[model samples]
Target: MNNPIPPRAKKIPHTLEIHNHVRIDDYFWLNDRENPEVIDYLNQENAYYKAMTAHTESFQKDLFAEMKSRIKEDDSSVPYFYNGYYYITRFEAGKDYPIYARKKGSLEAAEELLFDCNEMAKGHSYFQMSGLSVSEDNQWISFGIDTVSRRQYVIQIKNLVTGEILPYKIENTTAGGTWSADGMYLFYCRKDDKTLRADTIYRHEIGTDPSQDVKVYYEKDDTFDVSVYKSKSKKYIMITSESTLTSEYQYVLASEPTAPFTVFQKRTRELEYSVSHYGNHFYIVTNKDGATNFKLMKTEEGKTEKEYWVDVLPHREEVLLEGIDIFKDFLVVSERSEGLNKIRIMRWDGSVDYYLPFTSETYMAYTTTNLDFDTTILRYAYQSLTTPASVIDFDMITQERIVLKEQEVLGGKFDKNNYIEERIWATARDGVQVPISLVYHKNCKKDGTNPLLQYAYGSYGVNIEPYFSTTRLSLLDRGFIYAIAHIRGGEDLGRKWYEDGKMLKKMNTFTDFIDCSRFLIEEKYTSPVHLYAEGGSAGGLLMGAVINMNPELYYGVIAQVPFVDVVTTMLDDTIPLTTGEYDEWGNPNEKEYYDYMLAYSPYDNVKAQNYPNLYISTGLHDSQVQYWEPAKWLAKLRDLKTDTNFLFLDTNMDAGHGGASGRFEALKEVAKEFAFLFDLEKIKS
Candidate 1:
């Protein structure tokens, strides 16, 4: 086959001036999704991607099948008891969606089907169901569905007793609604039509028209987003308004569905806190009073004020209190120390306090699905780079635990012992130690010839935990090492780590990644010619920035729905998540932030250079990072890049930020990516 000609997007020079600074964007006209020309350009790019990768089609299919074979096609999640029923989400063989069912009182009881998502998703190209909420009475279930993959769901209630779907629908919701104690009313969040931000909270009465749903609260601040949930204690219906650096909560007695909400505390700048209702008090995990690592505090239910809060767990400089789970007899806290997860179990009376035993230094362990507060059993999940995920239930008093289920890798070739997992530290340019968790086949060696795929997402304090991926085994089996770089701009090392990599110090994130790459090469783990980098969304931004700064250091890169046009996206407040993310990536309206962001913005920084082999994918309907960013990026790169290295753009026209919302369907996307890497290394299975 002849070399495919890449799509060259037409450049209609558009000038943008911000803070008295002038910038020229040639492909700005591609932003209009409604324009037929824009769609044509995207289709052309997709066609080019198909043509360029046509030779690898069989390899991609085999890779996808190889990865899919490891997955148990007919599988059910561990049934968890909630309310009066045992709920289970199971996937039938050959089905792309799950079947949600419940049994009354016991696991042996006859199952009652709540949602067969496969049946519901049949008509939609992109479908996702979120915010599944069962009423307190367990007689009704509420769910939100997004057929467009824009994260905007339409909530619908169903009568479990009668097996009838309600006629009313609440549109443009964040998905899922918190039900009143009587199960007569539902509280849900509504998004702004233009920005897609959840800015309003509404209360809907069952059997009533959704159009008449009462507006419970409206967040006037553009920087803040709102969400509603029933307290874990099931006593209060809570509404939380939060920004990147601040949070404020309000509550109404779940019994009083029509009552107005009372503020737990007013929003204070830089004061981040989350509330959970307990017996007579509200337990809070907060960064109050300069507690950068966050501390635990409790306030009387009657006195929901910051002044009334007393320390339950004092702030520890070394430990970051990530979250907490309250129970009738105990309090479970999720903490992170030295970039490792720790789950601490404590009795309410202080009779016992200990962390659950975790053997692996680079494993992830956290509390999960402990809805029944009356029980002594604490349910949690544990997984490592070499271990499959296991959901375990623990007896706090006896210190005994039982593994409910471990993810079954079904191809018969799987063995945890066959892989080696380890944590290594790399020294950054500023002399900081960045942790990297790695996993590879035991046969693989730490030689410069080994191919290493490095991944990281250093943004919004989102820590990418070291966890196992069945699909990743395909890479390991092909003599590749998978590593997770715990770089700054994430909470891996604590809030301070994130703070040091944001705002004026944001460049540390890019430099730290590049430094890690250089360190890996210098240490003989992998040479520049054998190293590959991958990141999605914000991490995609990391990939773009690193390639721009040190393109020669990587052989290839895969950026999925990357937020690369930083300055432009951050400057436009109307874009989804832009306004609320001011604290994450500073508000670019100001000259200082404008200058800092523009300096590293990948699309803005693309110049005449020999770039690495690139594979970029985006969703046309993506709400978070607009599809046009990558489209415009590829166009400019095609024009300016001096290298003959292959650059491919794949756009998922049917999906949004999350490509392909299916069990096995999503693996095809990963297969394409893996194929790109394998093809570059000339390794075909």
Candidate 2:
């Protein structure tokens, strides 16, 4: 058998390779609990992971440290950690930069201090403390800090109007900011340590004492989080639970926080309303009628439980309804028909609202907000063949649109006109139609010689749409097409698309993605020899399985932060994301589930086979997908395979899933992925 791995990585995404890295070893966790190697690896990293958790326990010390550094008096260059106008100043060597807040008014250049990456990295796994999420109003900033143990950190806040730095108040070790309608009540839920699993929701007065004026919601025995939202009249408060895939929600009196009552409720299911809001009345769409279909309904009497469901948009056998929002009297939703997503707007009165004619073949909203009762501002990104990623603002009432601050908040020399986007359809093995979004240079010839790259994550009912990226432009300029395989494992074509690509139907996702690559070849969109595939986490599993099953189809493959060890990990409930994944990937404890998962568990099925130019990157700090899985799989490959496929590991000792702490750091990580792809150069046919 003459199997060989090609030089795809070096030629495509443009990154130099580190070769012949290690002498193969026996599987690291093969000995299970008695493994000495496991102890060595654990002792080394566990010490670091525990640092953040331990420091958080002593709350005062960590808070005191940040207060001293960023919250000190006379530090005007830092952001004013205020409620509305909150932003931070980064005084760099050659430039003075400002990190924008969600709203404007809270802090000034002097009042807020910038977070020190090095200082904050202490006591955390790189994977754990890697994200920063600001509240909708932009009054408070919440970030994950210290990974030794996972605890969401409460950063400083500034009064939007005054430059006064509010006293640092602890929300919860695990609880996050659940800002109120007025932004005064920052509610959060804490897992009662005694129970360890179940948590209790608590409302914090933000700037007040940690003890007084605290309101507690349901004290359940399951792990949970709170999502706070206000109705159009500001009379209702919606609090959704943080649970596994199917979490139930409870609505309470917003003005009467202490009121012991739930207004209306809907438990999360395959097709039920995951979330809802008010226009003049309650509007919701759920897969409740059937997993493959959605029944849209409106409500006026919320407290009364009634089956007053209306069918605004019936189930399209192919179109997937991604999400919906109530701006004013209108309801806006983004739908994925075939594989292209377009934003559609409708009215509560059952009349056609102004529909923003599907302009960008690839359109979707990231998040939305209401400016007033009649007008709303939708913040999202829009792109097509002629567009790069730019944040846009749409007036829901006036139907006016504006481009917000363009990206490159960090500054870069990016050419916008070099690349364009397009939609293409691929036929699946089961005669299903799949759509892929492609981005390449306008001047590039379609002679099957251009390097082509494809990315897909068909899991967890998420819809992968198009967005702008400068890191990817390097490949387009070099005659490469960047694509997103809108395959199964997502609601790309509605519930049926997801149902067909999940659990026992998971192989459909892999084959659909493969079929997409084949369609590209059949249509001469690109050459198979130049084709490359990549994905992280669940998508990484898809990439791993396809390459192993059909190595000849691809020239190169990159699986970063991959979840390839399916059977072993999913069955062990201890892994961070496993239990919640059972709804998506069937629980392997039962014989049926065990067989289904074993059917696709890539790590366990590694035979003496040739692989695509392979690059697997894992982070020791990855609390989600443990580093040991990929490390062990590569070891098996080293021992079993005689092919020239390359393996590379750049474990971030500090990052969580996404890797990197700041925006610049995050870009660097993304740049690394692009570098690997650029070097591989999807060899044109």
Candidate 3:
């Protein structure tokens, strides 16, 4: 590779004043997506990215091909029985989209095609199909389609028997719809035009014009977003409105679609709960009554108010009750404790209780589709860093387990025994222990000579599971260690873990990742020269903060769709996900929060100092973190940073928050990032 010139953004001074504090933004002009100048600057960055990495073009193609080769081009998912039909999703030999089909009773029955996304997406540059629901009579199917990739979907109906596309369509929706028992009406949530927030619930009659659909309910608060769905039992249609700190629900019988929704409970600040129905009562999982770790309660069907609630599973100090799945004669509770997930099973009569056994110390297991309430066999999914994802059906009665399907790694030399997975703890600055999950080839040593890649996303109480990835074989086979930092701000260790890393304590997330990185180097797993970091979205925020604070600790960093311009974006309520995020990141209108946000915001704090090599990515139509955020951040980084180390930006002009929609196409993006890291390490195939 040769020395190359980087793109420099023009400086236009823009002053922002709030609470008598003034800040200057030189690259603020880059935020206007409609401006021709902004588009030109982004294109120039893309060109520079290409020019700088032109030497590795062939290597990248090889990387892409290697990664794609692991995938089964024509593979089908395990069919699950739902509503008297067994549904399956499979990809064809040469298609980028999936074909959703179903069989009436058994696999021997004639297959019925519900949707072929490849046919529907023919003319669109960017496409996504979701929210597929079949009517009760099984004669009609309603689904949502998005062409622009901004997440705003249009609901379309089709007659399965006649194989004809209907004229009924609903626009600006959440890409989901629930059908009534009679299949005469569809209930869906509509998004606000400007904010793109799901704010209204509407009922659309099957053969009627969508313009005449009745508005069933509306959520007026900008802080709360709404969604509508039918319960698993198919008995009730529920409309729920939730915010970061609170939630409320309204329900109506599925038999009477036109009935007014009845409030389950009035909304209260700091109160959160979700309801599930089984038999004659409603089960509630909630944080009400100061249950920080959450608890389960029950109330009679007709008397579902706070006063009538009775404790079912009382709150435990160290255990976090994440969710509950109810069946006719049993209950499966998902709980987290000691930084690991556990599934608890109990009989309906409360006569017996036990937990499913798992052998792996660091792995992820979660409940899968169990639509029927009559089955004794519970279906779930499990995976580890060294194991491919597998679907298991466990019988609660006999404790027998069956492996329904394990993801096929097509080029078939893959073996679980060739790798090792371990869990280690890293002590934070405040003496808190954070868990780190790592995996490496059996041939790889714990010597400081090897390169390692660390990843984390410690925000929004989202726990980063050490799930298996076939694409990661490219790194492990080349002597690279892959690790996941289970830092704070995530619910890995319980709800308290998340509480300590958000709001004013958000800095803990950044420091936690850095501490884990240092721990790895100290343990002789890898040294600073060979240590690489990768994070996306909120985790991308982690990457930005760590790079600003300890640039010398990493050899290179990859931040995808980073939310770097935090203060500026949070202050603007017009953007999607901003207003509703006030609780997660405090409302900047307050003086205390405004000052605190400014101190850590990556864009506001980027200084004139030496920085690590960076490869950043974003999607032009991203609805979560706008592409301009990364674009402007890169512009400023190129202008102010003193280091001449490689800095590149790649923007997908046609995609949204999720890079590419196609299964094989998304692997290309991963190949590009891996190629960047490999090039920095001078590793060639």
List TM-score per model, in order. Answer: 0.99, 0.76, 0.99
Each candidate: what lDDT?
Answer: 0.93, 0.60, 0.92
Candidate closer to the true structure by TM-score (higher is better), 2 or 3: 3
Candidate 1 C-alpha error for residue 420, in Å: 0.9
Model 2 lDDT vs. the true structure? 0.60
Model 3: weakest 10-residue lDDT segment is 1-10
> How high a TM-score does candidate 1 get?
0.99
lDDT of 3: 0.92
- Model 2 residue runs over 4 Å out of place are 1-175, 179-185, 191-200, 205-233, 242-247, 261-263, 266-271, 275-280, 301-319, 347-352, 360-367, 376-380, 395-398, 406-417, 677-685
* Residue 489 lDDT in candidate 1: 97
lDDT of 2 by residue, 139-257 (tens): 55444344432233433454544545577655334534445555666555454332223245666676677667465666442334445544545556666665434445566656666
CA lDDT, candidate 2, residue 49: 26
Worst 10 residues of 2 by lDDT: 7-16
